[model samples]
Target chain A: MTSNLRFVFYPGCLVLQRMPQYELATKRLLAALGIGLQDMPQASCCGAPVVESFSDEWVYLAAYNLALAERLGLDVLTVCGSCTNSLKRARLALRDPEVREDVNRRLAALGLSVEGRAEVKHLLQVLMEHRAALKESVTAPLRLKVALTYPCQVFRPGDVAAFDDPLQPQSMHELVALTGAEIVETGVEHECCGSTLYTSNQPLALSAGRRKLEASRGADVLVDSCGNCHWLLERMQRAIWAGEPHKRLPVLFMPQLLGLALGLAPDELGVNSRVVALLGRDAHD
Target chain B: MIENCTHCGLCREVCPAEKLGGRTITSLLSGGDEYSAWLCCCCQLCQEVCPEGVDIHQVMMCERRREPAPDPHRRSFENVLRYGYAFPITEDINAMRSAHGLDPVELISAEQVRLLLHCL
Candidate 1:
């Protein structure tokens, strides 16, 4: 229950761009839980999923961020699953002598080196690890029913990126339960949100998202661990599947819901102003 | 030796791209279909469901790496290389941060990030 643990925060690209709300909520909630987060002033993208395979630069980019974290002398905490996965994968890959030599040679020009000592944990892991503290901090128990969705990175390849049970992650469910919200159901919990599919096939990505949204129709809110899934499930559904008569559900990133239970206001959590407005409308209904 | 594949199509059952392609994953992968490759989504679900333990996601990555055409994500990558972020930290974003009593977003110089990328 030690809340004094400090981690270097890596928000990754998607949060900074499309979902500052998640960042805002996370910062506030973590502060409330007495966990300290330090910022990396010069970190870049986490070499997000699809982009990594597109070029060799992706691995190096991921390595650069890892080396940056290593220099700070703190374990890294990432808000985005893609960032968590990329950094973790880079850390594992750098264990190879050749890969380390190659990456270090490149980093040498920038006067940085990958020590590979820094561990990367998703914010979900950090929160769940402190579950006792989180439960004690809940001042206002959430009364709504929620369905949880984890980013694909947290549960894949089983051996390397093993953040949880790949096929059936339990940490997210446990984390949500701490807020006193009921996990209404469990089907479609591990389905891909189709964020990466957008680049190649927008319709397929939308379809994948549509499937999840349709499946979660009975829940009052859809909960997500990463910003990309938030965007894919909520934003892309609006943009690409506008004509579809899918049930509309409020999607809350992990921190936002936790912040609510911690006594933070809707505005303080930076729940998308639009979502806030929608919630207002829901209250009247 | 284990059969390469029983053609069970279990991988296809879980594949988002294969479903979208309306074709076998082997056909979509071996035929060098760029659209199908792009649609793979890197979720690695196909790899998880394959009875033969075929790493179709890795196959997709290898094909994507060898693809001669410029990446659809090139512009965003360039933005990251140039700005140290893929999207702009606009006035509205800063306003939102400050509204929550949060400090403005920070970026290391794009030149600093670009230097590391260039070194690669």
Candidate 2:
């Protein structure tokens, strides 16, 4: 397959499994717009977050994934912002003559070494830049108003992979607008919704997620391009209701939200999950 | 010898460890009291983003190393962290990954879940 027609898509673990709807929706939307997503079959975790925290030894694993992409001769497209940040940081660090020499020495032990630069685009960045291309085929208009959220890792200072203002990014707003919807600015636009903390500290994650959900309670649907943010808010909304009929809120992944507006059926695009359930009937379905 | 009062809170505005309404970095550095500086996350983003480019995480870590981490619920949290079974494992079978030799199934930690995020 030629790289020109299809981008090498990297749907990091969360989007692939926990929220398969994201991948399904994204595939449908991209297909409608004549864009092909060549899933990077060999891609793996950018070594997760702790890989960056606990040891540089784990950094090599992510580096291996990056080098694999390099061999393919196309820049990688990562769905998770944290994965993008980690890969970008590793690439940046290894580019430094001193850092490269040091890291390469360790990598040599495993028979792997990353070469020069490669573009690591977040899913939002891809959508933002290509909105013009994708906007032409807007078949259905979205009526649901959305609250846009940009989590912390999407644009951290260390990796510096920001395409817009890291403090108050607008990619989500812009993309949602493509669906002909009003976008509201929530206070915790880039705040950590405590996704990683969810497994370790459910209380902490729920507390933080509640704060965000409460803030976006006004919107028709809370739209997040980040999987971590979407999952956290959705889970918290479930906890808040807990066997109650009124247990619901407007939480959705960016891809599914777009799919709804595009008039795709829920089953055709896999948007029938709880997230879209909050937005009322599958407008796309 | 008091290092002359060349009073410039430039050290305060530029330091990463000092919170928005917290103590100045110079005071912490000079007074040998590090508790005030131990809160830095050490990402060094603050220092690079700062105009003065102060190495605040380093300073904060230096002070933090001097004392024990102040975790009030350390004992309770330690139990949760050590067991890696903070959440109650579900009794009902929904979805699980099991090999030949395994100790039942349960959602363990963020680390394991994280792997599937990309792999899946």
Candidate 3:
């Protein structure tokens, strides 16, 4: 409710390992906007696709982190969509008294409990809520066109995510609008990036991601916050178009693009390390 | 649960993994080879379009639980078991973080991860 709420920053496993740039850019951007973030004393996977698939125990794993945040008296701000989904799913599942009791029994071993006090939110949800504040901090406007993948976990199962209208998402568009960037209308804008299937079937995942990329051929950049989606659409996209003459649109996290508009250098936002070079005013305008 | 299905096949229409599997949700749910479940990407597209409001993703998740952990996914889980993250915390990663003017990341202690995994 306040302009400057502090949250337990849950940089899910993927962002820390595969995409630290998102964390750096997000932290810097949040700091610039005067939002406070506290690191979790113990940050672990939210028990998503892998653990969630294997056992119901995944809920306990997710609730454990929520309990940690509750103990710290802070809500969680997850940078990864899957982590947000897993944590939210666990929170929702905990609403059933029987399930919460069972999970709490398991957490008892770890000296934790499913108190259900901590709320899990995707970064986009947080930013969208504070777009007005964020807009005031934008020193420069990004003139480039941007297309974004809402990432299934963050948008779908809309009843749980409750961040935006999944069928007609506007949160990302609203957030991007604050930076003065054009949100291009891509046909496959809402398609699943097939990121969860990357490990199961690489070709299928790549093909699904290619469809979205091909659809975004007209946009200057593709943006998404989900690490899995970013990995497929941005990193695997290169291999998907190997040895072919194709448009190379850099896939950026929302913060990276917003960071640029906030007047942070490309290096500070880790844009220089991106697979596709982003051409802004000084770079190629 | 099959009673909830309307046989409209709208879920199949939106599902990428079902397309890859060359099967429909009805077939998979109606005693088809469980291997078809492995093809599911867990994107939840099918769940979104199901007119009957049936969670086809839950069906696929049930199958995934039975299957042996896929190698890559297993490796990622093991990474968390060891380092509280799905990726190794190497010096290069630390340098990259420092280069970005970020503090060194402090992951959940490996001890805690192991204990949690064991308890769960």
Per-model fnat list: 0.57, 0.02, 0.65
The alpha-carbon lDDT assigned to residue B46 of candidate 1 equals: 69
Instruction: In angstroms, give how far residue A73 of model 2 lies from its true place.
Output: 0.8
For every model in order, what is the number of clashing pairs? 0, 8, 0
Please tell me which predicted candidate would have the highest DockQ against the true structure: 3
Best by TM-score: 3
* DockQ, ranked from best to worst: 3, 1, 2
- TM per candidate comes to 0.87, 0.70, 0.90
Root mean square deviation (Cα) for candidate 1? 3.8
DockQ, 0 to 1 scale, candidate 1: 0.52
lDDT of 2 by residue, A1-285 (tens): 243544666666455435555666676777766665665643444653433233244455466566656666667777666677777767766677886666566556545467745578777777777898757656777767688777556666533575676555667777787889887777766665655545534555566666677787678777777676777777467775557536367576777777677777766565546545655565345
Indicate whether candidate 1 or candidate 3 has the larger TM-score: 3
As for lDDT, the candidate ahead, 1 or 2, is 1
Candidate 2 residue spans exceeding 4 A from truth: A1-6, A105-112, A240-247, A273-284, B1-120
Give, for candidate 3 chain A, the lowest lDDT window spanning 10 residues: A276-285
- What is the model-wide C-alpha lDDT for candidate 2? 0.56
Between which residue pairs do clashes occur in model 2?
A12-B117, A13-B116, A13-B117, A13-B118, A14-B117, A264-A284, A265-A285, A266-A285
C-alpha lDDT score of every prediction, in listed order: 0.73, 0.56, 0.76
lDDT of candidate model 1 versus the reference: 0.73
